[model samples]
Target: MLGALLWGVVAASSLTLGALLALGRRWSDRVIGGVLAFGAGALISSVAFELSEEGTRTAGPLPVAIGLAVGALSFYLATRALERIGRRGGGGTAGLPLALGALLDGVPEQAVLGIGIASGEGVSIALLVAIFVSNLPEGIGSASDLLKAGRSRRVVLGLWLAVSVACALATIGGYGAAQVAGPGFSGVVDGFAAGALLVMLVDSMIPEAREKAGEIAGLLTVLGFAVGAGLSVLG
Candidate 1:
């Protein structure tokens, strides 16, 4: 349990780190776009190699498929509600979608990390790196936009810190849950994380990266996928 908490904190800390980086300097669109693209690629690799594959192996394709459908639908509904709220709030909504994505997805992601830890396989390096790398750009992009939208630095930092703490706790929660749940539950969690991530990548991250980085975003995404996939194979 303690190990899960520590690993969770380590993984989720990147959000705060990214926020701090964003607060420290003005990042160009290209840089932010590149980071987003790279993160997106890493996430794609994680969903494929770490989450989906493991889930399928653990339970079977049926539970994973059901989880994928449910997870995707949940994200869609939640995001739509958040978008409406953002529209009503005007510019204060800047960078909010990314933050929303992070919050929705982070729980399951960290929970999966906890499940893995409980299984006695120790930490999954691929999943850990993917979560950390993906979170950095989310923090940077969201904090930068929030700052531009007239939110104070303290408010932005506070928001991310809250998100970090919540995600960190998910690890402990997952550890506890996994102790009683069947193997199928782990598979479902894995599928759910993959589904949420896929939606976020398509609905927010990828489009934003393309807009900011132009053609280069595609190449960077490929490179990121290669690196992430390589890590999964090696680890």
Candidate 2:
């Protein structure tokens, strides 16, 4: 739990740093795209190797298959709901909805770390770190967007700080819940997280990178995937 909290601080702080960079208008698109790509890659690999296998191995292929399908559908609905949230603010807030998906992915996975330590699950520290590694680019993205909106640095930092705090609180809540839910129940939840994350990769990050950064963004996306996947295996 302490470790998770520390990670929360680090994640939030990283975003704050990104926001500062964005405020200066000196942050590179490639750097930002690379950041996003890195996170995307890490998340994808973790789902594929760690969570996917762990989930199916525990629940059996049948349940895992069902969970995966359900997860995807749930995320689809979530995406629409986020779109609604984005529409709520109109204009720039359209992308804001996607942050909910990011929160979903972040909090639960972080909770998994907290719960894992409490339960004596080996290597959970590494696992949470993987999730942390995935979150940095997202912070950069959020900060970059706010900067573009002509919001003051103070406002962007405040917004990101609030978002980061929510992430921490949500992680704590998720950790407590996952403890009671046990492996099978948590497996399903993890599956949902995986699906939601993929949606983000395709729906939010990919398009933004493709549009703003073009081929370089694409490369970074691959680099991010590779980084994520590699970390999953090694971390």
Candidate 3:
């Protein structure tokens, strides 16, 4: 349990760090775009090599497929609802969608950490690195947008912190659940996360990166994917 919690915190620490960076300076849109592009690449790699591969191995194709469909659909519906509320723009939790989106993305990633630990395989270094790297730009991008939208710095930081804590708890839960259910279930969980993450990338992260950075975003994304994939192979 302690190990699971530690891994969770270590991976999620980037959220806080990213928040601080976003809050600390006035980064140009281009720079923020580049960051998002890199993050998008890392997330794609994580879903492919870390989550999907292991999921297929553990849970078999059918369960993994079901999990993926469920995850993607859930995130899509939730995001749409939240986005509509955000557009209302009447100060009724305008940043809720941003925070929830981050949580949606991070929880599954952190849960995988717990699952891996519980399986007695220790951490997936590749997944850990990918998640941590991916989160940094998410933090920066969300914070930047919220600030521009007139959100308070304290609220922004608090939201990320809350999500971080939730992710840590998710790790603990994943570890416990894995222990009870056995490793066969890991694939379903991982596949669910992968699907959710992929949808999120297409729904927001990738588009945001391109909108801010333009054509070069594609190259940066590829570069990020190469680095992430290389790390996975090495790990």
| Best prediction by lDDT | 1
Per-residue lDDT tens digits of candidate 1, residues 52-75? Answer: 998999989988887888788888
Indicate the residue-level lDDT of 102 in model 2. Answer: 61
Steric clash count of candidate 3:
1
Global lDDT scores for all candidate models: 0.89, 0.64, 0.83
What would you estimate as the lDDT of candidate 1? 0.89
Model 2 Cα shift for residue 106 (angstroms): 0.7
Query: Higher-TM-score candidate among 1 and 3?
Result: 1
lDDT assessment of candidate 3 = 0.83
lDDT tens digits by residue: candidate 2, 71-97: 667667877765676568664553353
Model 1 TM-score is 0.96
Candidate 1: regions farther than 4 A off: none
**Cα displacement (Å) at residue 155, model 3:** 0.6
Clashes of each: 0, 6, 1
Off by over 4 Å in 3: 89-98
